[model samples]
Target: MHLNRALQVTAAASSLLLVSGCGLFSDSTASTAGFNPPNIKMQSELGPAEGQVNLIAWAGYVEDGSNDPKVDWVTPFEKETGCQVKAKVAASSDEMVKLMKTGAYDAVSASGDASLRLIAGGEVAPVNTDLIPNYEDVFFGLKKQSWNSVNGKMYGVPHGRGANLLMYNTKEVSPAPLSWSAVFDDASKYKGHVTAYDSPIYIADAALYLRETRPGLHIQNPYALDQQQFDAAVDLLKAQRANVGEYWSDYLKEISAFKSGDTVIGTTWQVIANLAESEGAKVKAVLPQEGATGWSDTWMLSAKAKHPNCAYKWMNWIISPKVNAEVAEYFGEAPSNIKSCDETSDPAFCDTFHATDENYWKDVAFWTTPIEQCLDGRTDVKCVPYAKWVQAWTEIKG
Candidate 1:
């Protein structure tokens, strides 16, 4: 699912508010200290739960035997847990939010944008880290991010993360694109041949560029925009629209474009880059010097989950080194498990995906779906709000 369209599904349901600025803390301070496990607990010697657990997740997060048999993760999880697993695929954040509201799902593999909404809506609850034994091993940097935690209470478990890289066919563009400016500011060079993710959430990518290139403008979080910052991002995108040959909401579409030599340079994910290469396309997921937007999908339990035991079991199974490696390679994102990359069958997977590599992470600005806090380290009185971003996005795409 395209990131922007995913966000649009939830735009009408909620508006972004201006959150109070608090002093930022490193990951060390954010870690849960002696946290209690969730109200439901499992026996150490017992087998998996003997019940059903429903999950609302993205399209490729779980495999139901439709894709390659090796790609199936849910069946093994169900077999190990002894819990019947029923899965629902959500293409966008908005769809996930709408589906979650029905209270039928026990857990959700939420992106940063939907995680905040689930927490705010009281649809999800804080995870009991003690029960999730593997939680301790999670990277410190990912443990207590702004979107996953509220009042120091964690609402979800970190999974995979990756940047929205500038993917271009090297055969078409020799030097390789280095910055977002090439796509956003000078798109005419590839006019009618460029593609970008279609959704409102993408406003953040534009905001990131403005924050670095035009600090004097004081644009903070793209979602939490004021009038000026909102206009600036919208204006920039409006100019970019003319150069866009297509606004892609589906992964296959973007991949097809790249394979057919339709799209020369545009926004894409790591998985697309890998797939492009397998298909014999000279594509590279470039980390522009200015930085990039990324997504960190979190596994969260529903507040009113029917089968908490099974949910916890699923969490453990999903994060294990073996399963983590499979999902990471299948989905094309860096694994959260530090050791998972080593277990992957593809010897070059780690180098290609940059899993467990700190230097690679530093080069890209991991996607932090805009919240009210304005994550750009702004100490000013205020920053752009979410409502403005929604309105501006509509105008930019219209």
Candidate 2:
């Protein structure tokens, strides 16, 4: 949604700004255009929960017994808070942003890609974590990040996190590959058997690879890339295309490919690896020496929510130890609530997901929209914004 609309803006607005002698590439006018969030005060006191609360979230984040009778969290939440829950499952970050813009939902489980857009567009309001008791137990590393905060004001509660790791069939890949170079530089060794995630966000993986391999590029941050650095990363992917078997977005498709021996190596999430292994595929996933790209989602309040009290209750309830563990175990990510580690069904689930290891994540770069104002704080040169990344991704696919 943002990519399609942004391309149109690039075509139309770039020329207008150019004619006015404005710095076209130095500013972002995509999803954030004409949006200035009002300085609204957060609710300081809890009140009676409303009768109902509407939510928009990723497919697995909110369960109401429709998908699987056993995977029900909403029923218990409703019984506790007296707030009936109704949720709409969003397919993408763009869809989440569009839904939030309607001002119909009380809250949303937003990924990094959509969180900042929602924040900048004034679709979501600042969250007062002091009011949520569970906020005190959330992983310290997940709090007050750039994607969920502005000027030190928190906008959401952490939901979960997972890394995009380098996965390979252990039997086929020799000597146990430890770097992303296996996919970028050495992919040709497994030519036509290598896979990659199908999204513009994959560009960051290439940038991450380049950051470690090509020091001359001076790529301080994968998401914050200037024209030259962006071009280099794009060129690398173009070259990598020659060896790619197929690009994937669906986990099932990837699992099938790995099982059928159609793919031997590529990028993947831990859940995919687990599923593939359960299916008897000898696959091993690694964070790689260069680290990895990852995602941490947040539950954000809508700016025009009609059930604010219920929304707050739901946010706190969702991140409480037991509920957070239930969601994390079911959704295949590390729970944001530290105490949730003890509540998981599988005794080793938290350790397997690296739930409490802050040191393990230092090298893992989380996803954030690439703004023109470089995230690394460089103002001397304009960086390639997310709109260009979207356009470039289309070309890379071609």
Candidate 3:
């Protein structure tokens, strides 16, 4: 999860594994045709729900009412399906991957970062959407995406969607900036007051900015960067490091920074912007002219799930109209279920988040794991992988 609350999925997810000999430097392009996930048979039919189901997820994705009295979705789900929900909150995608590998949990709310890893590692199974009756109500854009499906076979159900927007304190940033240049190329102007996400996945955000300004680079997909493009992005981040006051992974830290006037501008999500504003900080978030990095989370079932029937039932229940709206509104992201738009407590909630606006999301590039084989279809040279991105990120912060 990028935000403290929750966050993303992909089919091209499995495609990255096709690239062989992944290392510091390699010369090969990943081919989707060669990427064959373990031939695990898909569940053909539904069954009786188990007594309970265990879930590994981000903090706010599964609410049993312990956090806030008003935020109890799991309880109702339990009563309705007679399947008790036992959820464990994972602090990071890396942690989620480790947990999922243990096969202790029935389902997971996996983001794009971990979804592919799960698929390639044969940790999660292909979903039988026919068993999930509510799947038909899910938005068209959320279905069969590169993150949630592999070669047209669905692996998970879309939960929600959101973008990492450029957030700036109105008082510190004059004229209300509309482009990402305010934070990338011209970040020095706000030296010692700039911030960015504290994750290797953020490399794609840098790549996204370059996609427009550095046209000669021919960077098509931010996630699929060849050696040259990846280097350029790393270089840009290294330069920006001089102006970074902090690289934040926690929402509270970012909100506090903006409220204290210690940080003026950087990347953020809609929930952070809302929180900062509620605290009386004059902040505004925008999708920069160059588009922005986004997420589309999915509810995936573990291949070795102890409660397969319960997992399927839970997936269907979570995405149902009313429950989907409740979760989307509380978590502060666009609902993947179109019917959820009308079920929101606030009639205009969908409009605010562009919940049903397909065109608004056209420019938002959802997050995905970067592998040795360039995701952009370049074969002559290899692109940096996630491990390399982590090393580069550490170097940039230093």
Candidate 4:
């Protein structure tokens, strides 16, 4: 559940991919045969409300006024569409994929890592953007990408985006660090006070660092790793593990650790850093010069959804400007809808998250599934897939 907030799915999202699994990286429809999506056709026309829509999502995504009475957006949705929202909070992307496979859920707010698996496994269907009136207002950067689409066909509406940042205690750390090396190369300096994200996807952070530090590896993209590149990243993590006081997945535990001074420096998200600071921890977060790993979540429709129309309505309603702003602010991520910037409670919120800055995002490597083919345009060798990454993460943790 803690990972749900920082959300590291087991996917390998790369920043510079122009094509992925028979699909263009973004907006380009061309696909290769090895990466064909399922044969399911998108719904041509939307129909009446089905009265009930079952949803599986990361925590805080489907808030129904239960957690904080003022934080709910679900009640208004139900009244407007006559759709009874039956929401289940999924602990991780893996769980989200498993729940959608059951055919009980109508939709899911899938992160990039899970979205690709759902599309490839045929658990979700291609979305007809025409049926969603609000689709036009969505940020172009969030659409037709490797994670949420196949062969240029979109499978879901983008939910939001956020980056994994480097956090350090201002007083304990001598100087503000500008690169990932603060955790990898100089981890011993911090001794048993460094922290890192606990998930397979975090392997990309190591790979990302090596891509800049070890150009001899010729690592073009962090997610697309040949055997040699993958080994190097794994080795780096194994070494860093010695200095890591703990690997965090839950937000509460991390906040507690930071506030207690048990973790002086480590990987973190903006939300966690904010909470820790509010709790009197002298912490500051930075994106670092090497950029960072991030996630872009999507609202995917289940292929076996029992209430398709209502699910469609929910997707559109959630991404509407006001709603998108609410979700983005409460969830502490950039909104997928461009107009949402204007609706946020704090006018500077959009700038703070770099919500509308395309150039700023070029450095953020969004999470996506790594496949047999290299994501960095290397045709000479096959890149290690996500399964290998999972195995390596377990070994590194052990």
lDDT tens string, model 3, 1-398?
A: 12121111121122123211222123213233334678678899978888999999888889988999999999998888899999999988889999999989999999987787788889999999999999987877778776677777889999999999999999889989899888888999999999999888899999998999999999989988887998999999999999999999999999999999999999999988988999999999998888999998999999999899999999999999899999999989998887776577776677779775566687898887776666666777777778888898889889
Query: Which pairs of residues collide in model 1?
Result: 4-199, 5-199, 224-384, 224-385, 225-384, 225-385, 226-384, 294-367
Query: What is every candidate's alpha-carbon RMSD to the true fold?
Result: 10.3, 13.1, 9.1, 7.6
Number of the top candidate by TM-score?
Answer: 4
**Which has the higher TM-score value, candidate number 1 or candidate number 2?**
2
lDDT of 4 by residue, 1-398 (tens): 12231122211122112113322223433232257767998999998899999999888888899999999899999999999999999888888988888899999999877877898789999999998888887767778877777767899999989899999999999889899999999999998999998889899999999999999998877888999999999999999999999999899999999999999999998888888999999999999999998999999999998899999999999999999999999988988887776677776677778776676677888888877777666677888988899899999999
The lDDT ranking, best first, is 4, 2, 3, 1
Tell me the spans in candidate 1 whose CA falls farther than 4 Å from its real position: 1-50, 220-224, 373-387
Error of 4 at 84 (Å): 0.4
For model 1, state the Cα shift of residue 15 in Å.
Answer: 43
Steric overlap count per candidate: 8, 0, 10, 5
Can you tell me which runs of candidate 2 are displaced by over 4 Å?
1-40
Q: For model 4, what is the error of residue 173's alpha carbon versus the real structure, in angstroms, after optimal superposition?
A: 0.7
Of 3 and 4, the candidate ranking higher by TM-score:
4
Candidates in order, TM-scores: namely 0.84, 0.89, 0.90, 0.91
How good is model 3 by TM-score?
0.90
Model 2: residue 173 alpha-carbon error in angstroms? 1.6
Worst 10 residues of 2 by lDDT: 24-33
